[model samples]
Every structure is written in structure tokens, then in C-alpha cells.
Target: MEPGKLLENSELGLRILAGENGLNRKIRNEDVNRPGLALAGFYRNFAHDRLQVFGQGEFAYLLDCGGEVEGRIKDEFFSYEYPALVFTHGNQPPSCFIKKSNETDTPLLQTTLSTHDFILNFNRIITRALAPQTSIHGVLIEVFGLGVLLLGPSGIGKSETALELIERGHRLVADDMVHIRHMGKGELIGESDPMIEHHMELRGIGIVNIKDLFGVGAIRKKVQVDLVVFLEDWKEDKEYDRLGIDEQTMEILDVSIPSITLPLRPGRNIPILVETASMNHRSRRMGFHAARSLSERIHSRISQQITEDAERENPPKKERKKASPKPLMGPV
Candidate 1:
């Protein structure tokens, strides 16, 4: 976003302090750095690309710095290629820092929010604005509180399966081009592209508005992608996991999501399979793994049977009859 728009945005409530000429600066990344160490003459490994944040701690540290120290800090801090400096909790920046900001053509921003709150809000804003994103040809649906992405080749009935899912009361997030963004820290958010949000394309029926056909409750603006289901045309030669003992994963935007593959064939109920997969994934996350538990129980029973058969085959020999010699010796 342009540096000027940061203040004009109502949700952030940032005010421009100085460097009006730098309003056109573009913030290309989502990272926000607090310069607590930078104010203390420590510049090792300093993150110069992020927006610099000066909270109460940093401000206090700056107040304690000697004149030469403060000058050096300001000179070196503004000398880098940072986007801007933000002071939290309505705290006014020192006069010398403001002068340096103006001299270096760096934008100075102030917010009325507390340091913690402003950091939270500013980071959220920047993350959404600059998070890594890509769009894919698939359908996103929320089933049983889980987001399931259906991926397949063209004309493989992804939209048809999604339509059935919608009919089954599950909400559709996006169809036929789901826009996804990785919000860092293992979060992958999916949404419909603006131009095609709430719309779907069926092979024979043409395009349709899901929201219009299925009401507002059948659609969502966005959803976190929890599970990915890849549907493929059934191949007789390819082996598919029947017991689900070996779970699969697919990586998107550096985030590894729990994934499962479904073989599509004639008369196969894709919607039901997707629903069951969603529920099973939720169960796994809740710490109940059905496949592993069943395997363990079956193995235990088989081992017990094997031991019983071995005992029966050998007919464990009985101990020989003992004499009463011990009693007689004691008496003697």
C-alpha cells in the first residue's frame, strides 16, 4: 500500500507526523520490526525492510540516550531502506528524530492505540495486504466446520461435487478458481476472487450464482483451508490407500496441509466422500485416529491367536509327580 493510505484507513487510525513527501512509498512486505535494540546503538542483524515501530519501551530507551548516542541512533536508523517509523499510543517522536525523519525522507506515523494493540492491528493489516497468494482451479467448501478443497483436472466434476455439497447444506467458499493466501505461521486462508465470488460453472448447465440459488447461508466470504482433497479419475493400475494407514500431505505456499485422494468413477458419490473425509480429518485433529487404533487392535488379536495356536501345538508338557521325600526327611 502507498504510505499515504496507511493513515487514511479508518481501521488503523494512523496519523502522519512528518515526511509528507514519502507518502508514495510502497510497503512490499508484511513484517513489522520493533527497534528496541536499534535505539541502544545495536544494529547487528537489523531488519531494515520492515516498518519500524517505536513503542513505550523504545521511547523510554531513547530518552535515556546521551546526545551523541541519540544522534548516532537516529542517523543510522534513518540511513536504511525502511518503509516508515510508527510511534504507538499517541506518543510524539523526539524533535531530533522527527528532523532526521524529514531529512531522510522517511514517513513518521502515530497511532492512538497502545503499543500491543497497535502492533497487533498494524501487523494484521500489513499481513493481509502483502501475504503470499495464488489462485488455483478448484472448489473450496466448508463442511462440518472444516474447509475442504477439491482439486482435479478440468471437466472432472469438481464444480458438480461442490454443487452437491451446497445442496447438502454445506457452505461454498469458492468454486472454479479459489484464491488462496498464506498468512504465515502455518495459516492458509482461501477466498473467492472478487470477479467470480459466489459463482460456479457447471459443464452442461453453464454458469450459476450459488448465493442466488442457495441463499446467503450457503456461501462464505473466506475460510481457512484445513484439509485438501484431490479427486482424480479412477485408474485401474494405480494403487490407492484402502486402509488410510498412511496419511498424505500437500504443500501450498510452504504450508503442508493434510491431504487425501479420492478416485472418481461412475456412480461414486463424491459429495458424501468429501463430507466423510472432512469429518474424519476433524476427528484426527481431535486426537482420535481410527485407522491406527483399528490396526493396533487387529494386530494384537492376531498375535494372541498365534500364541494360542503354538501352545496348543506343543501341548505344554505337565510337571512330573513329586514324591513325599521332603516330609519324611523333616520327620527323621
Candidate 2:
């Protein structure tokens, strides 16, 4: 696999499904029997009070006030046909068992659902289930202050070029799977996922440890990306750019990264080309655009042609036309 590839995890998911470690809890028949229980999950009933809660799933929230959800759930017992419990604010009591109001000072699940304390606890549980371990596998390249994601068909020598770049002392930000995070101002910060950090897979060879081979100086935890280079097979008929004047860009996460297409050929040293392209890209940002320079040169030659043609004909200058204003009524 190309470096930085994410693998599937079924064991942990299956374990959660197996009801291991109290991950799965069955709702009471009364809870499942309720009308909205199909839509939400379970409902909580309070004793000696007008308070009632309708919540669902492993993550549930209490309704702080009646009619919070207009026409959603009614307050009467007939409106609540599901099972629920009351418990103390912070205590972990039996959620499934029915409770008498005076029996325990602990608030029922319904009473505490809207409290900040409940939301925090519920969030913690939800995040735990969704989190997954990720790994890093390849060098992440950024150019021209624009984030470029260089993705191509596999075995196109992406890592090898990156290795060459590192040998030349350019910093290696991430290898393989880059975890790209979009900041508030639209900046894309890419980092190698921690679990698979500093590792690379080279074709015709096994996994190589980048940190061990190139040392700590070679690897960077994160960096901003600016360009994307997509390397592919060279076609003779394909019109490769003769001049570096056109600006092409690839966008990811709503941020545009300047892009270049590099053709892979036997005699071509791709690393050198990519690096030079990156340097040239940087130069363009400094206002020394090569394509614009060429275009201006062409324009200058065209202007000279017009001057030569006019001189050959030696045409006389025409008189300037004057604007004719409307005649005043008295003058007529």
C-alpha cells in the first residue's frame, strides 16, 4: 500500500456491538413501547412534578422546560408511554430501574438531561466511540504558499522524490496520509497522523522508517501546503507546456493550491524537475512570472510591427473631431 493509507478496523467496532464493557444497554419494554421512542430513543418520567423528558439513543438530554419542543412530546403520562429514571446530578445510579421521588435525592435522567453536567458526560461518551487511530506514510509537499495535494495513481515514485528532496535538506512535513485541518481563516494545516508518523513505503522494497534513515531533521509534524504535483505517464502526443507561464491550481477543503502536471519518462529525473518547479513557483510568487515575461516580450514585438507598418504607409494624421453642441433658441 502507498504510505499514509488508512486501514479498516472491525475488531473494535464488533466489540462495541457485542455489548462488551457495558457499551450496549437494552431499553426497558416501556421505553421501547412509547410512540416517539422509535424516533428519539427513550423517554424519562418524573414523579410529583410537571417535568418530563423525551430523549433517545446512547446519548440523551433532559428537557429543562415544558413545550421546549413545540408539539413534540406531551407532559401527561398518556403522552409518555416509555420507561425512564430519576437520579442524582453527578452520581452513576441504575438508569434502567424505576425510582420513587423521595427514595433517592439523585435526580432522574429526565431532570438532569438539560443540565450542563449531562451534556458534558454525553459528549465524552460519543467522542470515545467515534475516535479512530490514524497513521502517517508519505512526504507532504506544499508550494507557493498554496496547499497542494499531490495525489496520483500509485507507484508513481512520490516518496522517492520526497526522499530526494529531504536529501537536499528541504523539510519533510508529512508522509502518506496527511491529516488536513482547515483553520478559521481558510488556512489548511496538514499534519501526519500521529500513529503512523514518519514512515514511508517504497515500491520494490518494504516499509522504510523515515526518522531512522534521515534522522529527526528530515521529518516535520505539520506544515501549510501550497501546490500539488500530479505525476503520470508521458505521452508523446500530449502537449506538455513549453513555457512556465500558465497558473494551474487544485483545490482541497475549499483552499486552492497551485498545481502542475509532470509527465514520468525513463530519462527524466522527476525529483529535480519537481524541486525546480517548486522553486520556480516560489519565484512567481515574488512577482517574477516567467509566462508574463514571455507574453510582454511578444506584445513588445507586436507593437514594433504596428510602428513599422505605419511608417511604411506614412499616413497623415487626421484632424481631431469637435463635439457639436445644441444651438441656442435665440441664435436660431
RMSD of 1: 3.9
Clashes of 2: 25
Consecutive 10-residue window with the lowest summed lDDT within model 2? 1-10
Give TM per candidate.
0.80, 0.53
Could you tell me which 10 consecutive residues in candidate 1 have the lowest summed lDDT? 323-332
Off by over 4 Å in 1: 1-5, 26-49, 54-81, 87-103, 326-332
Task: List model 2 lDDT by residue over 1-332, tens digit each.
Answer: 10001002221111111112221222211111212442242445333222122334212322332344322332232333222232323233222222322132212343333334443443343333333323323358543333445566677788778777778766566667877765435466677768777887778787888789889876777776666788889989899887767777766666677888999989998877877787787888788888889899999999999999998899778899999997777654
lDDT of each: 0.88, 0.53
Best model per lDDT: 1
In TM-score terms, which candidate is top?
Answer: 1
- Whole-structure CA lDDT of model 2: 0.53
